[model samples]
Target: MKKKLSLLVLSLILLLSTSSSIFASPSGFTESELDTIFEKAGTPQELINQMDYYTKLFIVENSGEDFEFSSNSTSLYKFDSTLDTFIEVKETDIQPLGYIPSTDMSLSMYTFNVTVNGVAMKEIYSQFEWLNKPKDFPAGIGKDNLGIALPGGYEIQSGRYACAVQTKLEKNDAWGAASSSRCTNQSPVVNNLYGAVWEFSASQNYLNIYYKGTVKLTARTVSSNPVKRAVSRYSQARENALGNYGVSIGIGAASISYTPKSGSNDTMDADTNW
Candidate 1:
């Protein structure tokens, strides 16, 4: 009887997943309901393994707190875990996500948070979804586009980007990204090569909105500390994220996306095709 109920509950989740409109765990998918289901499946992470890509099952410890998740309408802030705190946060200043990146690197890689009109959010990241990256870039070009190569005695051309094989890439159709020419004002930008859709962490609330802005690239510098390198990298990333990458930021979103521990056999893959 318990097994039958589990299958019935799963069918309902699959049914809800097909809807185009976003919902916060569905109107009546209360914590008690989820707890009952998950108790059968094992851990929350284990439950994710049995589901298809992008299919989310939110779990809540508080049965009466009214936990929810949904995305629609464009706003500076898209979530309110407090049930409705979609307002700017307090006198909080944006700080590095953790200990600042080492001051001895030459590539950009750091994280921080900021508030707009008081709404607090953190910068996600700026990088490719692996599938969109060139299968085999030149030796010096980093797929992440975070490094500035200086091959010995080779001419330092303007910062370069990696490109994938023609046949392997999705065609420049309506699904492909808009032409890079659309933003003549931005530098160090790359087209998604795919349109309307974006790669995101499935565990977070799908805010699905973006902000655009420009960022200046790092001029040639003699700095060797990782701090300087990290700063330049993050600044460019944040700005380009606002401009080209469409950095997704919001409050109440949890890092539910699972990251396997080292040496694990999980072949982490993105949930997109073509």
Candidate 2:
């Protein structure tokens, strides 16, 4: 009886060890299998991120009175292949706008101070509603109804930094006339009612806006007024994508406008997967 029990124990131990060794082996993905995956993973969006890094940089040219980017929310991320995460590289809600480009030459400067309508200037918020939100804006907003005043003593680039503004349009009856002419042909990918605007300016600096095509502004207010507007760049992108993989940052550069409101979207790259 004792000998039979010993044999049973040894057989069980051997069976467990063999099972573990089978899983521990590299059969699932040998060097050859990994090569196949690398060869098969050829997609356009992946190519763009590899080639250009596709990161768009926009400095907060105007810091009007309103919401500010929360400390935990402001971040820069780079996609990590091994971990499949957008690793945060730099983050700061308090970082002031820097690398402000001159309106005349679009030349980026390193240091400067900016004010709006005599106010010393705070952070840029896309709209007043974001300040009232329970969570505040998950994403930082843009500033409007203000002029960027660069105190002459400081250089332009020192105070500049890049940020992304998410925008949404409330296509109510009021936008009827302008929407037809400006947005009728918008790509189905963009909400058409929303777009992102990236601008750069310094204290008393000039800004020139160029529309890809000639845009006839029926009313100056129609283009400049910040009404029925909200910033939700990622939100709109997600919505437009439906349930598909959706867009991640570094996909491509989004084309934008400068009139404070109502911009069109353009494809930065042909590859949607990016």
Candidate 3:
């Protein structure tokens, strides 16, 4: 009986040693298999811990600073070439708009203060809302309030709510509009919203979490306002793709003008199987 029991124990050991190869999946497996399978591997706590570690690694590698993740909610950031550095700016900072994360947020002066390899950096972003001129205005009297302010004597006549995202160097107050999106070393995947409204921006290294999300302005536009009426609804199919932007950082950028409030749904690449 003792000899038989020893043989059975040896057989169990052999199975345990070979389990990895036995269960190993071949190449070309679908992505869904990864999100589901690995998540099923360990207990809830173990998964959380693994996720937390990976999140930190990703942040540090890209931003060159330590990244802090939260259990509840947090604001995400991106690097601005115009700003020359990265910053996490909350719209609530300048205005008392009520959508700040529960925790108190602070602005960083790194863009103003730091330089890499002799090149200066810009950090903070200055947001602007689109204010198109009313087409119905009297022939002589134009609709654009910013006619004198903007270039070429052209008013904000693009009733399509053209929200031009602008930023200033923390070193100085010279602000420039993001005339063209150029962060990831590639052409912008989608044509910026041709219609009046747009929000958020993305790069190859870091993509806006909101798939359909556009470059956000500091303020919101009134959909009911006569001057800023939408001609057509937002319709861009490529916005739903994940392959376009390799990695992602979710910015829960929101505006009171468009609500129920929205946030980014980020899929971290920490899962090796994916």
Candidate 4:
């Protein structure tokens, strides 16, 4: 009986040890498997070239006072020629391939700043409603104002407001939008003015490669009475005719835009390879 008990305990210990060894690495892949991926990639640069990533930005009104932007998530994918579709690469798998995670590389360090008519405005960070909900937005379509909630009490005056995102990377590298949307409405009614007007610019880097592409969304308000009417007419006419606005951000096949009503479901990719 004593021998049988000892053998059972030894078997349990061995099983636990095996399980730990199998899952010890952050990635579930074993060292041998990672080596195989590296071998298949051919070169380190090619391994990076095989991967593509994108970030999502959602701009929504906060408690009818100010706008809130959420960029808490990013998705990475690797092109599989055989599958003919991009397969998602887990966050844990990024470092194993000798590349920094997208979140760490850009998203985590992003800084958001607001501006009114070219003058910087203050940004207040607090617990927002959308933060609790899922961050999913449609990839490339437009929707109505059903879920949108804009601020109120500014119907008398029109202004151009913007919320821009920026990130400082290694080796004095910085990337962000040059400008944002120039059209916005102060009334609580969702306006037909929906679009993204920003250019993402990046400085050249010789030492290390960083993400050179960017996607940004911002809110704007036009205050002058005459300009407001003109904007309203232009926006309505465009919305009624085209139904959507497509703005190209001229970076490695990346383009982003908004819709006629909701302006929430837009996404773009920033390729890491040169």
Candidate 5:
């Protein structure tokens, strides 16, 4: 009887241990792993507070997907010695917008079209050029043109429509300088881009809807630090048939004006997304 009771107690202990191991976390992360992540993210409320605007937007856009963390050969997290913890690395792509400039770094341009609610929204023209002793050329500049088009016969609900354009210069994935422009019905001109004219459809159906603007970034020397220029264009329509809808496109162009040292600029690749 004593031997039988001892066997029963051992089996129960093993069963309980197995159950606890199986129910550690929904993401299949062990308790110790979860503790490390939480420690890096700080308190629960702190982690929530640290979420930025873009992060929230991403969550809303991908609400149907389950969020999980996995470590492997292609894991996004990397150990940081300064913080003594792991940090997630976000990789951005500029392929969706259009062609990326080659290493030769000549002039390149692409046009991207956006459609919302079965209606054509606008066209974005992104261009980058290397100024070889052009009159008063500092280093390089980013030029963008936005052309707005609204299909006829389709009645657009009266709502606010806004467009924003941004250009950023970065070196080694670090931001250097930026310029932006925004236009709306209430404010026809926010920032002027090379004296470009902005036009809107003369129809009452669409209260405030038009996309016309130009954005230019100040040039920076790239003799030592090879940099990349990223141009982003975004348009938003609020209270439309599909509720609030927004479309954004971006492109990145590499600058090779100055010859780079062997293997020194290997990590200067450009990756941009909007």
Candidate 6:
């Protein structure tokens, strides 16, 4: 009877996985890999043995919150614990926003509060996640974009961002994230990519939300007039007195969409896809 109930619940989750929403966890891997995973058959104990084997193969943890295990690794299998059988998280996770300055490639700490219906919510992260990053990063490149060569004078380049959520809690509750269909701005300014997302829960009179994170990209822009500038003669004279060069800030054009972590903004869904 318990096995039957587990199967029923697992089926429901699998079905819901297809629905367009932030909760869907996609299986991360190639089609062939997925087929290989689907070919496995088993009970919960067998699935755990398989998962343990694959986890060892990848040299990664067998189970970790915020870390979705949808893809197969031969050692790890995606199973419906309720059903005691294999299942898949079609899409899971979220993308976060913000940029890292090129000067110091360090991860910035960003914190925001969540109020659903009207009350604030709390969460926790893992210590290993925080400790794994570098203390100080490269001079001009962030961890995300590091080792990727770029042309000179190219101060900014756009790319997708996938961040890990670091929470310190017994339950290991965290913001699962994915990139929105819409492109957002991000900077590889830190040693390792880390960001947050919000998840949601509701009651008769209350709605609770948590932050999940994923990777997406912001568009790149070029200067319209890179070498030409107009500055005031008087300003130039003042600069000469201070032994400074003429200064004129040139603005470029680009577009970026970001998600706010609190209030009504915390509620995100498939429509939020870019």
Best by TM-score: 4
lDDT of 4 by residue, 159-187 (tens): 32332222223434423222222112212
- Compared with the true structure, what per-residue lDDT tens digits does model 1 show for residues 1-274? 9999999999988888754233234445533455454444343444334322212221231111232221111111111336732232222433233211222111111122323234332221112222232222111111112211111211212332221111113323112221222122223332221111111111112112121111211122223421111111111121122222222311111111112122111111111000
**Global fold similarity of model 1 (TM-score):** 0.17
Best by lDDT: 4
lDDT of candidate 2 over 78-139, digit per residue (tens): 23448853344333423222211112111111111234344332222221111111111111
TM-score of each: 0.17, 0.16, 0.19, 0.22, 0.20, 0.18
In candidate 1, stretches whose alpha carbon ends up further than 4 angstroms from where it belongs are: 1-127, 130-147, 158-175, 181-274
User: How far out, in Å, is residue 130 in model 4?
Assistant: 25
Candidate 5, poorest ten consecutive residues by summed lDDT = 133-142
Q: What's the C-alpha lDDT at position 62 in model 2? A: 26
Would you list the C-alpha lDDT of every candidate in the order shown?
0.23, 0.22, 0.24, 0.27, 0.26, 0.22
Report the lDDT of model 4 for residue 69.
27
RMSD of each: 21.6, 23.6, 20.9, 21.7, 22.7, 22.2
Question: lDDT per residue, candidate 6, 8-94, as tens digits?
Answer: 999999878654343322444432343234333222344344322222112121111222222111111122337843232233322
Clashes (candidate 1): 15
Candidate 1 positional error at 93, Å: 27
Counting clashing residue pairs in each candidate, in order, gives 15, 26, 10, 7, 0, 47
Cα lDDT of candidate 4 equals: 0.27
lDDT of 1 at 215: 20
Candidate 4: worst-modelled 10 consecutive residues by lDDT? 228-237
Worst 10 residues of 2 by lDDT: 211-220
